[model samples]
Target: MASEGSTPQQLSDDFTDLQKKLQVVIEARQRLDAQLSENQAVQKEFAELDDDANIYKLIGPTLIKQDKDEAVMNVDKRLDFIDKEIKRIEAQIAEYSENSEKKKAEIMRLQMEQQQQQQQQQQGPA
Candidate 1:
C-alpha cells in the first residue's frame, strides 16, 4: 500500500507536529505540578499564621487585666510585631495569587496556540 504521491516534506511535517504536541503536553504537566506545589506552600504559610493568631488569643485575656505597666508594654510590643507579620503574610498571599493567575494565563495561551497549529496542519495539503 505505497502512495507514490507522498512527499518527504509531509512526513517531516508530521513528525514535527507530533513533537510539538508532546512538548505542549509536557509543559502543561510541569505547570500543573508547579501550581500544586505553590498551593501547598500557601497552605503551610496559612497554618503558621493561624498558630500566631492563636498565640495572640491566648495572651490577650491575661494581658487585659494585668496592672503591671512594664508587662503590658512588653505585650504591646509583641502585638505590634505580630500585626506587622500579619500584614507581610497578606502581601505575600496577594503576590502569590497574582503570579498564579499570570502563570495560568500563559499556559492557556500556549495550549491554544498548540491547538491552532495542529488544526492548521490538518487542513494543509498532504
Candidate 2:
C-alpha cells in the first residue's frame, strides 16, 4: 500500500508552507518596527515642543490645525497599538519557527528511513 511508504514530496510541501508563513511573519514584524520607530520619533518631537506650538495635521491635502495635546494623545495611541501588534507578531514568529524545525526533522527522518529501505533491497537476501 502507498501508506507503507511515505512520500518525501508531501513533507517537502509542508516544509515549504511553513517557510512561507515564517517569511510573511518576519516581513510583518519589520514593517511594525519601522512604524514603531516613526511613531516614537513623532512622540519625542511632540515632547520637545512648547505647549502653544502650532500643530497641523494633513487631512486630504489640507493642513488642519490640531491641538498639541490631541496630537500627542494620537501618537501615544498609535505607539500602544504598534507595541501590541509587535508582541502578537513575535508570538507568531516563534510558533512558525518551531513548526518549521519540526517539519525539517520529520523530513530528515523520512529520508533516512527511505535510504535504509533502498540499501536493504539492494543487498538482496541477507
- Indicate which candidate wins on lDDT: 2
Q: Rate residue 104 of model 1 by lDDT.
A: 47
Give the CA lDDT, 0 to 100, for residue 16 in model 2.
Answer: 92
Model 1 lDDT per residue over 65-96, tens place: 33334434555565565455556545654654
1-126: candidate 2 lDDT, tens digit per residue: 113354789778878998999999999999999999999999999999999999999999899999999999999999999999999999999999998898888888888988999999999997
Local accuracy by lDDT, each model: 0.51, 0.91
Best by TM-score: 2
Candidate 2 residue 111 Cα shift, in angstroms, is 0.3
TM-score, cand. 1 vs. native? 0.45
